[model samples]
Target: MRNPETILEVDDLRVYYATPQGDVKACDGVSFDLRSGEILGLVGESGSGKSTATGGVLRTIGSPGRIVSGTVTLDGEDILKYDDEKMRQTRWQKLSLIPQGAMNSLNPTMTISDQIADVIETHEGRQPADALRERIMTLFRRVGLPERIYSMYPHELSGGMKQRACIAMSIALDPLVIVADEATSALDVVVQRVVAQTMLKIKRELNVSFIMIGHDMGLMAQVVDRLAVMYSGQLLEIAAVRDMFARPAHPYSEILIESVPTLTERKPMKINEGITHDPRNPPSGCIFRLRCPHAMPVCSESRPDMVEVHPEQLVACHLWKKDENGSYVRQSV
Candidate 1:
């Protein structure tokens, strides 16, 4: 059984990619706490390294990927040192993954029933198909898909149905923590809403914590309790969802929230240019200083430490500092 108190905690996570050119620091010093029933949002641009950090949690980091340093504690126990024997047991049972691009993960040739059956079979401890089939049917119902989908092949399912099936597969084990890594990105708005609804339903019904990794702030705000902002390979801000959207502390987060298209104008907010593409070579001092609207000489010359703004908010910016007279000071660029 999983602990109801702390579901997952990532401390000082560092994931690097050893490439021919140089070591690319995809995730450096990433840390966060995931409580039971809490949804944590990982928001950032395309190459912000959010995916790599979560991927490392489940030991799913692809070739040349390295976890270099950090401790991933699931239910107060370190999971980084888990043996393959233990990892095989913990992967789906304790923590599950609903990967991005569901279309690519499903095998077109196999029927949905067989595909799901294969996962249960590979995991061990799960019962035979006869006993599991009924559960599979119920999973389909939970995800709002018809039970008849069990017999259909991957090629027979629509995009949304396939996505739902992937979710069903991930949740079959009833993991304590579910990492939905951009699970809704490929769908249309209607389907995205449906998926989000299903996710909420799953969370409520299963009492599982979530680490929702995606770039959609509005969508994330609707699902997660807190949002963690990442830039290059660093976490710039961590705050309550409402606080993040209402008043972001980090310049990078502010820029990201601003980029979200306001319904009034319908055009997305434009952020100032410049993001280092090559992860191996992030800029000196503050990684976001080059694009930060509030960048100061101090910001470009030294890295700002993570400063606690409130009981529940943490930010990495020199601007949140106060003057000796106890007045808040907003530094100039």
Candidate 2:
């Protein structure tokens, strides 16, 4: 079968934050692609540049933070080059964001229906009141939200309802790609599952792509088609969720997968022992070498380029080298 067409591509995207002492590399040469109708999970620890990378794509980085270099191509166009007016026009029409905190993202004063209607009116101009209400009702139903909450304020809904409401608003315009940055992070476990199911249902009905950023490995396993691991502002590995879980290519990926708790067996978490470098001053060669258990002399010499270690599995690590046949073979330290 043919591969799905690429919908969004981020190439060597670099985002930085200015500070009194130096520039912090919030997203240093991170790269990944979102396939049409596929959900890509961006997983990492806090401050791993997952959100910064998404912010750069949405042109939401402000003040001290800026896109230092690279390109974000959406539907064959480099959106990073769009003028302010064009970008604004493209936001809900072609791309949308379901921000981290639903409580903070919504307006406390405006009713949920009005808030959603405001988005529709802003992008598509004024509509008849009845038609608008019906449209909002359809969205609510699609996301499994009750229509009763449409007239209620933000403070009135439960955490799951608010999140589902946000999801409804995000799909109001039928955007080509939606960046859901920890959309369920603040919810209880039961609520998180419900919200996740709502997102999956939306994806199936709308055939839209997504970039779901979070630290939940279990959630990532259930929802994402492909997984991209991030660390120290760099993409360490990208692979199919099953392949990565079965045979993680990068050491960091292995450690991350191993850290997830299991019910059948008990094992010590492998990720809490390492110390990451300061963002402003990363070490030369491989950024993960400092914390990697398999560090070698070559790891500190020069950075390893992303190499396809197996079919459709890419990893940035010196331990895997191309042999005479051009197949990646493990090397002894």
Candidate 3:
């Protein structure tokens, strides 16, 4: 468990799209907290608002994208009101993001060293030209990349190496919390492991937290301390990694964990049916009710409230109630 001194807190975080038809709720009433040296995994199928929720914290959502309602608090401070100047100053220096498809995030035209130097030069003020090369070299070695790769362009290095270079750039200022939006989603299995390992190294060295976003349950299990499961823009569950894998309270979380591929698992993988509804116009009630096998009448009548079931374990499902005899019975997922 992370120390109670929280570094980030997101309460009822919502990001929406102002479409011609109506406002699309990309992230709806999302809330979570993070502490130093902790990794919180945000897992959901595509368009489930995994990235949108976190992206709102970075204020990276572009035009047509708007945070409809929510509060993003960093170190007990609400950042939603930050002006452009404040955002520019706080970004990368206090908080940084290694966005999804980070391979393309780097400027292909610029040298690897130049890219890292750019962030340092922009935020850290001017320095002698001679010092810039040395700083880049120090960061490269910190991320376990060869110092010789500094002069090379992004095309020269392999995917894993490029990821490491990006990591070096991400931690150049040792930001409090790093948002990694599917940081390893684009790589092969071997490279994914490599990238995850390199990320661990960087995390330990910097003692920073990570908001890792991905749908791969197994991959997230390996790195994340706590898991936040999302379904159709709403966070359905958050629990310790072991509890979430062993006894997932939410039906959505159980499906995700059971879907993880295993060596001894010769049976066909469990696949969740039904597709995510378009954000422009969503379902009438619980977003997952259409696909949720255990859903009941109440699920379709109204959305469930996120209630605390245990320490650090919150589930947004009606299943956590009792039946006639007072025995806890899960709802018809």
* Total clashing pairs for each candidate: 0, 0, 5
lDDT of 3 at 282: 80
Tell me the tens digit of each residue's lDDT in model 3 across 1-333: 234778998988889888889988889999888878889999998888888898899988998998877888887678888998888878889899887786798999999998888899899888799888887888888878997897899999998888888888889887998999888889999989988988888778788999999988889889899899987788999988888887899888877878788988598868667465767888777888777778788877888888766667888887787568765556543
Q: What ranges in model 1 sit over 4 Å off?
A: 1-4, 126-129, 266-271, 322-333
Better of 2 and 3 by lDDT: 2
TM-score preference between candidates 1 and 2, better one: 2
- The models' CA-based lDDT, in order, is 0.84, 0.92, 0.84
True-structure lDDT of candidate 3: 0.84
Q: Count backbone overlaps in model 1.
A: 0
Worst 10 residues of 2 by lDDT: 267-276
lDDT string for model 2 (1-333, tens) is 124598998999999999998999989998888899989999988888999999999999998999999999999899999999999999988999999999899999899999999999999999999999999999999999988987999999998999999999999999999999999999999999999999999999999999999998999999999999999889999999999999999999999988999888877655465436877889999989998889999899999999889998999999998899989997766
By lDDT, rank the candidates, best first. 2, 3, 1
Model 2: how far residue 76 lies from native, Å: 1.0
Model 3 earns a TM-score of 0.94
Name the 10 consecutive residues with the lowest summed lDDT in model 1: 268-277
